[model samples]
Target: MKTDDAVSALGALANEHRLAVFRLLVQAGPEGRAAGVIAEKLDLPASSLSFHLAHLTRAGLILQRRESRSLIYSADFVAMNDLVGFLTENCCGGASCAPAAQAASKKRRAS
Candidate 1:
């Protein structure tokens, strides 16, 4: 992704509501959740959720599909991976990065 795309994605997630919404969609998996379900789960008004969803869609952080009368939203894993990659492209000079430690920790924990 370009710098501007990453920046826009980060900007969209910078808000508490948008971040929460995105995380919820991630948890929801590829099947996604309907707009009404999101609003109800987040305790957000329909109008507010709509605005947040629009921002997420525009940022390429989420995908929306029309299923019958409902609008389903899901996390765009590719985009998410890109954002993570862009953020950590050169972490700690690429050697002392936390991802290395994190990977080791996961291996140790699993063993």
Candidate 2:
């Protein structure tokens, strides 16, 4: 993704509610969740949730679709991965750092 796109996605996730919504959608996976379910799970008012969802949608970080009466929302994994790739493209100088970081992550997870 371009830097501007990554910046927009980062800005969208910068808010607490938006970040929570994005993470929740990511956990939900590509199958996604209904708007009502998201509001209930996040304990957010419909209006508040709608606002945050709109922001995320505009940022291209999430996608929304209509399923009968409910609106389903899912994280845009390609965009998310792109943003992560952009952020870590030069991590610790380059490719060599990734193996060490992966090892550390694996060790932490094992513990």
Model 1, 44-108: lDDT tens digits are: 99999999999999999999999988889999999999999999888787577677789999999
After superposition, the stretches of candidate 1 with alpha carbons farther than 4 Å from their true spots are: 98-111
- Summing lDDT over every window of 10 consecutive residues in candidate 2, give the lowest-scoring window: 90-99
lDDT of 2 by residue, 1-111 (tens): 898998899999999999999999999999999999999999999999999999999999999999998899999999999999999888887557868888999999999
| Candidate lDDT values, in order | 0.94, 0.95
What TM-score, to 2 decimals, does candidate 2 have?
0.86
lDDT score, candidate 1, position 59: 96
Instruction: Provide the clashing-pair count of each candidate structure.
Output: 0, 0
- Report clash pairs, candidate 2: none
